[model samples]
Target: MPHSLLAVPPSRGGVVPALLAEGREVTGSHLRELAARLAPPMDAVAAYHFGWIDQHGDPSAGDAGKAVRPALALLSARAAGAAAEVAAPGAVAVELVHNFSLLHDDLMDGDTTRRHRPTAWTVHGPSQAILTGDALLTLAVDVLTRVPEPEIARRATARLSSATRGLIDGQAQDLSFEARVSVGVEECLAMEGRKTGDLLGCSAAIGAVLAGADEPTADRLHTFGHDLGLAFQAVDDLLGIWGAEERTGKPRWSDLRRRKKSLPVAAALERDCPAARRLADLYAEPEPPEGETEDRLAHLAELVEEAGGRSWTEDKARALYRSALGALDGVDMPFGVREEFTAFAAFVIGRDN
Candidate 1:
């Protein structure tokens, strides 16, 4: 197992259920093998990014993050009546693509830390971080090419390529929204659906495709992951505004500080309340050189909550969660597998970090 799956102090809060832990272990083995092929410092940088080694090259695994994408891949194959190994290639590819996005995202967003540690882009140069992300993305396709059947490889490659395009489009939209004076909740939802939902849908369906599942079953699995991805992003937006810095591994009011028009912020902006108007005014003001705006980020957060954004976001997440679970109902799977999927979905919206 990746040392990341080991129990840590409750203070550094996160949840990695046994299912996710198993998936992480399988993905880890493949990741290590791929990283070893890179030349010199690049290998070490990749290792460090995955929490398998520290900056100085000492062994570690305290912060590799939950492998939710890979776990979905594994379960998806099983749900289609295949063994976990049938999903291994897809699982690794999904995990690599996820980390690729994270590396680039941190660089683009000016985020300095992730998983309670300095981000790869901050420690290494921005150029290296970009290179690493590019390499990982290439490797994601390479992983699929290793599958025995040529047709399976071709189909999986198409799935990943399509998802990557969605992720890119979503990221671009997210950046564009930051420049806009106002953002609609619907637009934000669409962007998030592309950014987070596309890959998750791929993760849930790719394995089934590899396992020879029929089109309808794979479609249902895709729906399950896609809706869950939206719920995941909703919870993430809540954390960006209100989560504890210690547990969430991000600054308090992180989204407000970045002027992110995330779900809550966009919903608040759509409201008719005075708080929403003031929030809009605050957003319209020039961004300070240091970005604190006289430390009004807290006020921005308060304004969002008062405008009913938080409640609206929370309710939306619950609804999305229900929709995700409902998508699984049409698929044929053992009762226990269904329950496992349910628990995992619950954990997505409920996790503290």
Candidate 2:
């Protein structure tokens, strides 16, 4: 079996950790400053959501996510021969958008925990969390509009807005998929491409836009990010089924519990094998799986794997990773930056959390 298909233990050291370390060092303070610019209540809510503060609004440090979007923005800028600082606003904008999505997603998905901490909706109430998400969405546009160069700001803002719209559409599709008994594998892939890929693609392109790179170069970078984002989502779907609860900060078999039509589940459903038929029967049960016992959820996960979902998703992820790297072919990027980007791609496939 491919390593990514197995229930491998989380990696302690890898490109993700290294990039996250550099990302925190480079963009951490800037992101906090931006978050602090919100109104008083919203600032506190945003701070807590960003893992910069405790529920009581006191200073506290937590996971704060992987900072992948910001890292991509900065790296894309550097790849375009511009200083990382030139893309700081773009990075901040992407981060705000990312957090905005997270806040809304937690509310929509009824998730109680994030990054091993109580989610914003759990701590601050749903209304406050919703308003804070709204604030973050607006703040993303505000950050882009304040960029010193008007043309660049305008381009970046449009790109971000378009991606945000796609993200919303994708979320809607995801919710709708749950109500249906059957969903096509292609449809699921497209939904994920938009839900996850759109933002990453925007993150990649915004840097080039800010740096005034040519259209072809910007398009190539967008393709790179889009493909990478699909691979990232595939890995995430795998983790949703098989990752350690401690590392993922979610219950074991959380995806199965929710009946989420993630890539693997969808692929398994599409198969005509006996295991797939059995899995379908389980999903067809009238009651939602939320109240299901761990044993039942474990069986559902096994059915998915027995139906070939795990290997299918793993192969798809690896293929997308290669396609992402291929998208960078002949693009003008610094050697060190290109090497780093390549390592990041590898890390996405092998990541445990």
Candidate 3:
């Protein structure tokens, strides 16, 4: 059991386009029209949060994130032998919930930027951002109710609720990990499962349920999604340190500046090295020198690689990716669909940032 967290993903080009197209079809202008009818007095607020306009009802340069959760919903449905049309609403609802989480997370993490723009809290302040996130969550529930089938909505509500709880638990555990310098790799994996994997599990389960998949089939999809989510996060951790700014949308080594307890740092800490001592000292330093930030970050990267953290994390991600593919292999789905997912997984693993 390696204690490091860096992950190098596989080739992922075809995966993103498929997922994005599915999401676009599910939650396009037509859904927006439907949402408008259901939104009532706060319709404008919901619209703004969706990146359609500003507080004053003027058009704004808002962002639409990668609809990963929604894509899972649609893909799971496909794996269960349903057309994308039948699962569209469920996909929309999951995406709305994911965006809601992002809104609140940015605030909690004190991130000033999101989706290549200023974060909601950074521009609107904490109270409004909190309100916006809450509103989005409420809308997510509302969107689920409009899904045409009572049973599907009921199951979706349960799944989404459970996923939300898992995400909250994961974040709590992640924050807690920071307070303690040393932690086991097992605990870190469990934390990743909760923080990042649960929502993915829910995405697959909900899609399978809507497609009328058998219980066993749905369970396998759940497993696949969970493993894939873990792999995705591991790769993301790698990007936080050594990735290019253009691709990642952040300065290089921003994680070091934040002292985030990423897999690389944890791995370095687990090993006995002078660089580990230097890292400990750096962690203790109240304020990292503004002038030396880049140089120090480079040194930290060297330490991470030297401690075998980078290679270890990459290997773990590869193992998890392989496990996810194995889970998919056990299922009887269209070869083309499965190929698409495989490509997507590869893209996730091989992303530049």
Q: Residue 352 in candidate 1 has what lDDT?
A: 72
Which of 1 and 3 is ahead in lDDT?
A: 1
Question: In candidate 1, what are the lDDT values of residues 1-353, reduced to their tens digit?
Answer: 00011121121122237778888888988999998887767787788899988777889866898899999999888898898779999999999899999989999999987888888888877988888888888899999999999988888888889999999999999999888999999999999999999999999999898998887998899999999999999989998888888888887778888889999999999999899999999889887777585358878888998998888888888888889989988799865678777778887887778
Residue 241 alpha-carbon offset, candidate 2, angstroms: 0.7
After superposition, candidate 1 runs with Cα above 4 Å error: 1-16, 289-295
lDDT tens digits, residue span 242-322, model 2:
988888888778788888889999999999999999999999896553678878888999999999998999999988988
TM-score on alpha carbons, each prediction: 0.93, 0.94, 0.87
Query: Which candidate has the highest TM-score of all?
Result: 2
lDDT of 3 by residue, 1-353 (tens): 11233243444555668686777767666446744764343455455556676656787766666677777788888887888666666676677677667778777777776555566676667776677667667766777777777877787777778877898898888888767766666677788888888888778767777777777887788888889888878887788788777666666776776777777677777778887777777766666445546777788788877877787778878898888888876789876778767766666566565
- In candidate 1, which residue pairs clash? none
Which residue pairs in candidate 2 collide? none
Full-model lDDT for every candidate: 0.86, 0.85, 0.72
Choose the strongest candidate by lDDT.
1
Error of 1 at 92 (Å): 0.1
- What TM-score quantifies how close candidate 3 is to the native fold? 0.87
